[model samples]
Target chain A: AQRVTQPEKLLSVFKGAPVELKCNYSYSGSPELFWYVQYSRQRLQLLLRHISRESIKGFTADLNKGETSFHLKKPFAQEEDSAMYYCALFNDYKLSFGAGTTVTVRA
Target chain B: NAGVTQTPKFRVLKTGQSMTLLCAQDMNHEYMYWYRQDPGMGLRLIHYSVGEGTTAKGEVPDGYNVSRLKKQNFLLGLESAAPSQTSVYFCASSSPGTSKNNEQFFGPGTRLTVL
Candidate 1:
């Protein structure tokens, strides 16, 4: 079975402050990880993937095989960054998502 | 493209009532999925289809049924709705291949409440 854990249900940060959303995973093989985000009144959308190693909205995540973790981070939090974030693992043509973390960027 | 569209943005069903939720994707994605999101819980897969005419159960498939009669459409059914079944349902679709990295496109979601 594949599992994704976000550990934190909510994270509050001041504008311009750094933000980190913790995520951990359990899988037997080489894994694929992704971060998905859902803004208020919007549908869920992909934030970034470990494979692409690309940053979206100033956020990035590095897949750490040794630690079995893929934590999302951003140097500066923006009010627009407030949304629900989910860590997901792909296996057997399906995605296993974490419970999710709701970020609140207070001004 | 419309991406993915789900019918009946909101619904209320009585206990023991039956209903079907429809999802359609115009992206020509080969894979489609159904998931339910409960309060304070992650989205749990209920059923999925890799292609038309094929359906497979997911982690929480005990109380749901699914069919993919058309490549562009997938339907989820509830033979008997229960209060516990009240939640938001989301449908997603993706095409496989290409470095094994394709993000699923999600619908707006359907809010269901069972009394």
Candidate 2:
């Protein structure tokens, strides 16, 4: 079975600091990875995909096959970056999502 | 475009009551899905429709029924509501089976509580 794991349930960082949300997956075959975000009082939206290889909102995730991880990272965290982040794995036509990590940026 | 929309943004039902959640998409997507969101459980797929008039069971399909009578609308019905069914329901749509990568578009979600 395919599974997505996001170890941290909540992460806190000061504004302007670097942020990293750990995500790991276990799948039998090559997998497609994605990062989804949900801001306060807003619907969940796609943040980025590994296949696109593009960065969104200063956040980027690189699929590390050797480590079985696709951690989301940002150089400088902003107050607006505080939101819930979910890592997902696409298997055929279905998607498996992680438990999600809530990032809190404080001044 | 509204993208994906779910009806009855909020609802509270007594046990044994029945209701249906409607999801509509204007993007002409071929794939539609219903999922329940719970704390520490993430999103669990309840039912899905690959195309018009086609419905399939997902990871957690028990106690739920779904239908896709039209190309743009998918309905998820709970015949008898239970306390365990209380969760935020999300509807998503994507153009898959034809597109290389399936990027799903999500709805605002419906908050359902069964007491």
Candidate 3:
């Protein structure tokens, strides 16, 4: 079975501080990892995908096959970055999501 | 384009009552999905459709039913509502392949409460 686990239920950081949200997965095959974000009053949307190897909104996540980890990181937190983040693994044409981490960037 | 839209942005139902949530996508995607979001649970797939007239059960399809009679719309039905069913429902659509990164475009979500 494919499973995604996000260790932190909530994370808080002061503005301009670096933040990292941990994600780990259990899957036998090569994993396709992605980070989805949902802001207040907004719909859930893709923030970044490991295959893209790109950053969005100052956030980036590197897929580590050895550790089976895909942690999201940002150099500096911003108030606008506060939202619910979900780490998902895609397999068999479906996505298995983590419990999610709520990020709060305090000004 | 409306992208993806779900009917009844908010709904309240009593236990044992039945209701249906409708989702429509104008992006002409071949895949549609229904999911429920709850605190600490993130989002769980309730059901999905690969194309018109084809529906499949997902991770948490126990109490929910889905139909894809039309290519552009997918409907989720609950035979009997329960308090545990209270959660925000989301509808999403995506293309079949990885050309679009398999990104699912989501609706604003339907907030359902069963009291």
Candidate 4:
């Protein structure tokens, strides 16, 4: 079965600190990975995709096939960066998502 | 463009009641999806449509029904509401293929609570 796992349920980081949210996925075939974010009172939206290889909002996720991971990383955390992040995998024309990690950047 | 829009931003229902959540997209996307978000359980796909008049069961389709009679609209119906079904429902639409389709534009979401 194809599944995405985000080990952290709640992650707290101090402002200006480096933050990393772990995401691991299991799939039988080549995978396309993505990161989706939802901020308070805002609609869920795409943060980045592995195919694009581009960073969004100062965050970047590298798809590591050898380790079956696609972890999201940010060098400096900001209060505005606090939000829910979901790692997803495109499987058989559908996207499978992880349980999500909520990041809270403390002032 | 409105992108994706879901009706009834907030709804409350008693057990056994029925309701339909409407999703409309102006992007002319060929794919539409319905998902429920619960604490600790991210977004679970309830139902999706690849195109008009073609609906498919997703990761979690039980107790839910979907229709995509119109290309721009997708409807999710809960035959009999249950407390277990209480969650925030989101609607999204995407174009076909693997490249640009990776981006699924989402609606503001509907918060459904069943007592």
User: Chain B alone, TM-score of each model?
Assistant: 0.96, 0.96, 0.96, 0.96
- Write one digit per residue (lDDT tens) for candidate 4, span B1-115: 8889999999999999999999999988998999999999999999999899999999889999999999999999999999999999999989876567757889999999999
**Superposing every Cα of model 2 onto the true structure, what RMSD results?**
1.1
Poorly placed runs, candidate 1 (over 4 Å) = none
Better of 1 and 2 by DockQ: 1
Candidate 4: residue A100 Cα off by (Å): 0.4
lDDT of 4 by residue, A1-107 (tens): 99999999999999999999999999988998999999999999999999899999999999899999999999999999999999999876588999999999999
**Per-residue lDDT of model 2, residues A1-107, tens digit only:** 99999999999999999999999999989989999999998888999999889999999999999999999999999999999999999886778899999999999
A1-107: candidate 3 lDDT, tens digit per residue: 99999999999999999999999999999898999999999999999999999999999999999999999999999999999999999887688899999999999
- Estimate TM-scores for all models: 0.98, 0.97, 0.98, 0.98
Model 2 sits at an interface RMSD, in angstroms, of 0.7
Better of 1 and 3 by DockQ: 3
In the order shown, the candidates' DockQ scores are 0.82, 0.80, 0.86, 0.87
**How much is B20 displaced in model 2, in angstroms?**
0.2
DockQ measured for candidate 2 = 0.80
Residue A102 in model 3: shift from native, Å?
A: 0.5
lDDT minimum window of 10 residues, candidate 2 chain B: B96-105
